[model samples]
Target: MHPQRECDIQAAPTHLITLGAEVAATLSKDGSLSEVLQICSEIIAHYLKTTNVCIWTFDQKSNTLTRVAFGGKDIYTASLPKTIFCQEDYLENLKARLLPCNFRNTPFSSRLYTLVVENNLVGAIILFGKEYFTEIEDIVLGWIANNIGLAMERFLAREKQQNRGETLLLKLASKLRHCLDFNSILEIAVKEVRDLLQIDRCHFLWYFPYCQNPRITITHEAQDSNLSSLLGDFSAERINTLFDKIRNLEIIRIDAVRESSLDLETQEMSIDLGITSLLLIPLKTHSGQFGAIACSHCNGSRYWSDSEVELLQAVCDQVALAIDQSEFYAQTRASALAAQAQAQQLTQALHKLQHTQSQLVQQEKMSSLGQMVAGIAHEINNPVNFINGNLIHAKEYIEDLLELLHLYQEHYPNPARQIQDKIEDIDLEFLLEDLPKLLSSMRIGADRIRLIVLSLRNFSRLDEAEMKPVDIHEGIDNTLMILESRLKGSGKNRSIKVIKDYGNLPKIECYAGQLNQVFMNVLANAIDALSEAEEKFQIQNMQIHIVTKMLDSDSLIIRIKDNGAGMTEEVKKRLFDPFFTTKPVGKGTGLGLSISYKIVVEKHGGTIECLSEPGKGSEFIIQIPVRAIASFN
Candidate 1:
């Protein structure tokens, strides 16, 4: 080599060092990756007196170059493309010869410098200038390129770390939003912070802000298994410095307790608790409650990064809001429970009131009808008995008179003409033949009247005020007799047939009057159902079947079924509810089945249910105890 050229190589270090110091100052400043890269490009462009300078970071995984920063004259920078391929035609000649070359059709020549760290390409810098680079300039550019590579690597690592912290903080916030329990929220906050920062222990300090010289308690703790617990209570004065900081809503970070500018006592106390490094993030909720989270390092001193501190502070803020909401919920829960219980009680009382009203109305109607029927029966019974008794004697007298007339007719062969004319006028022989038949018909009519009086008296059961042994079948039969008018065909309506399947049941001890009322209600409902069906579908052969059977020694079942239009499921569900009816307003009172259910189930300690389906039929099954329980009676 020539002597001057060789000397220039030795002189290159002094200039390179000056340029390197400028680049270092730019990298050290607090700025984002792109900003720092732009400043670096500007510094290099000024030193070279170039037209333009641009930097592109290369991603080895993608094998692509992405333009990141630009500096130099605005006129030249505006025309530059934001990205280009590493193997583009313009770059191929530069890569092959490792020299400055004209880029595309531009008048100025461009030099491509690869920025490398650890002998691997991380990025490239391009410079546009009129003059080619000298040997010393090339050496200085290589040094600057290496510094840029190192800066890019450091910023990339920091960005990745920040992204990770952000992800964890987001996860913690999402979990806190779903949590309602106070202690659980605190536990999750501390545990997540500890795991995110990889610390030895984390705990929450709960304090009341309203109290004078407030006290604090370590309410929740999350730590490594090998560490001792920090669960305890302390007076406010014990850690006055910490309390003051929390009151101010300040974060306290101590890299090493021994080296921190804390009071001597706090330092010693922290050491005693085996804390080499500590970070405390204070929280103040909207309701004025205050708390703090303490993250500690027990094994060795730890450097708490800025990113970690920021993430923990964010998590603490979310936790404070959750605690405030949980406290409000706790206050409202008791009132909610009380209101629910009161609602239940009111519903039950209303149901009882309705039942009592229906019972009173039904009893009044039944009592009035029974009294009228009894009065009519009594009035008719006495006269019918009188006529029936007299007819027996009258029949004998008529027979004797007829026999004497026949004897006279046989003995007096020669009768006067006047006697014969009188006989023709009176029709004597016809009278003798028809008179006895007339008396017989009168006796049968009186007997029918007596039978009807007996049925009316049986149905009323007014004499039996208390429960007594009664034939269940007799009460049912009486109810049928009363409803006979509804059963028979009239006009266009078809007759509803009655089918009875009586079982040999023993006399059951029950309230006969009330039991009879139940039979009346059920049979009346069946007749009404058939009547409606007759109009709608004109059902032929409509029938109501009365089935009775002894289920066992202790109980008996009475089933009353009708082959009429059945009810829907929704109607069946509320079938026995009081004042619920499908009939026209005046046609039905709607209390029949409800009253029957109460009498059978509540009064007699029995069960009653209706089985029904649409277009099929409905069946009411009532099961009563054989002997009435003493309490029910």
Candidate 2:
């Protein structure tokens, strides 16, 4: 709205203004690295009167240069590969020296500038032209390089913050997933957030805006051991003249509460309590906002960063979700209890009806989900198979092309200057050596995807949901395949090897789908326990052994044992109890083992038992009848 910028370069001073303004404008758009490079390259090339401008990032791990974006005529020509082979002697020399170098006047006058970030060579900016750059032009190029480096740093920081926020949210959701108790959920939410952010004090204040009492009552508080607790009620009526504004705010951050425009009493209280800064985020869901989370900094007047604010907001969202889930559970349990108080006959009738209805609903949902997975797998298989089928031909075509190029080089060693320069620019020698490796990598990736698709089809087993004589080992193997990633461990968990000892046995008559669910839940639990034990107790030798065999030829037995931090007898007693668990509030819903028990004992006329003691690992033994008591059509 203010003014429009001219596209042409005017004077030396004007060049600086134009370059600065263009780079600033591109950066302000916050598009992507490609857009920034494109705009900057155009401006730099225009000012320097260069024919071409390009940026190639250096990959230190592979010792290669990847061309990110470029601006010029014939930029996408076949004379160059997307990746510049850094094995070339010219590049080796330039990289070793870490300095700007220009080529002699041959096909064109070209110069290469190193883009260094934090003493590490991150990239290269190449400018090609008929005329070399003047000293003034070099100065302008340096200015552009500095701006580009700073912009890249900013972008990288932004990406890291975004990734961290995502990880934090995922962890919060996972930890609170099994939690049903309102108080327990609140405790975990406050403690998790306080520990993660290293905040001095974190408290959840319950408040209902619609109520006559605008009182903020602290339900839960997590603070440093040295810090005094603030777990009490406080009135908010006089706190803000515009209470609606505070209620609707995404986040209310006071960097220096002592200097803030908060009520005089609030400011005085904060100063007296040694609170430098504070952040209040309203906990909200689709239903309503019933509370706010207060995070305080007591050390000094801390500047609340945008990332920190976002993290707190995400944590508040998780808490709100936990609250909503807790309320839903309470309502559902109340309804079920009220129905249970009817006449004995009616109560039994209702119980059977509800159980049958629930079973039907669960089966329907599972069937629909399995159908969707099968459909997706079918759609993906065809395309992947097509790629795999043509992959060998691709390799053959590349080999033939390489052979032809080799023949050309052998016959005509002394080519024209233009052809020779083109060869060097394209780094054809490195390409010939790397072409097969690239093809092999693609083949490996395709094979991995195909394996994942196969695993999906095996695990779902939608057709085998009804009673059928199926191989139990196949179900176990499929579950293991799906859980392979968790077993291999990651940044936060330790790996555990699964030892399978299967005695040759005929296919057992049972519900294959239900048996598969049991295997998944049991195996998943063992892996989770081992992972937690690995981090907490620093246990290096973690293992889970699966043994299956026919017991007296009438029944089949399976024992799943793990060398993890064992549970006490008390835990073992309640291990199969419904809605009872030892896991953290949100981490477990206590239904996995219960379902497994019902499937093994009630449905299959089998027995399930858990044996464990402190310091000794837990073992779950499941025995099922092989010969069915009912006839199968």
Top-scoring candidate (lDDT):
1
Q: For candidate 2, give the lDDT.
A: 0.76
Which has the greatest TM-score? 1
Residue 473, model 2: lDDT of 90
- Cα lDDT listed for each candidate: 0.83, 0.76
**Model 1: per-residue lDDT, tens digit, 1-633?**
357744664677565556667888998888898999998888877777787788888777776777788777755555555655565443455333322233445566667887777866677887777777776887667667776888888887788778877887778778877888887888888887788777899999977656775777898899999988889877766677777888898889999888899887778778888999999999987778788999999977789888888878887878877888887787788788888899989999999889889988988987998898899999999999999999989988988988887788899966899999999899987887889889989999899889778888998888888888999998888788777877897898888899999999999999888888889888888888988988999888999999999999999999999988999999999999999999897988789888888899888999999999988988999999999898787
Write model 2 residue lDDT over 550-603, tens digit each, in one string.
997798899999988889878888787666778899998676777777788777
- TM values, all candidates: 0.81, 0.46
Summing lDDT over every window of 10 consecutive residues in candidate 1, give the lowest-scoring window: 94-103
Point out where model 1 deviates above 4 Å: 1-21, 50-54, 60-65, 71-147, 173-188, 209-215, 219-222, 229-237, 305-308, 324-342, 379-438, 630-633
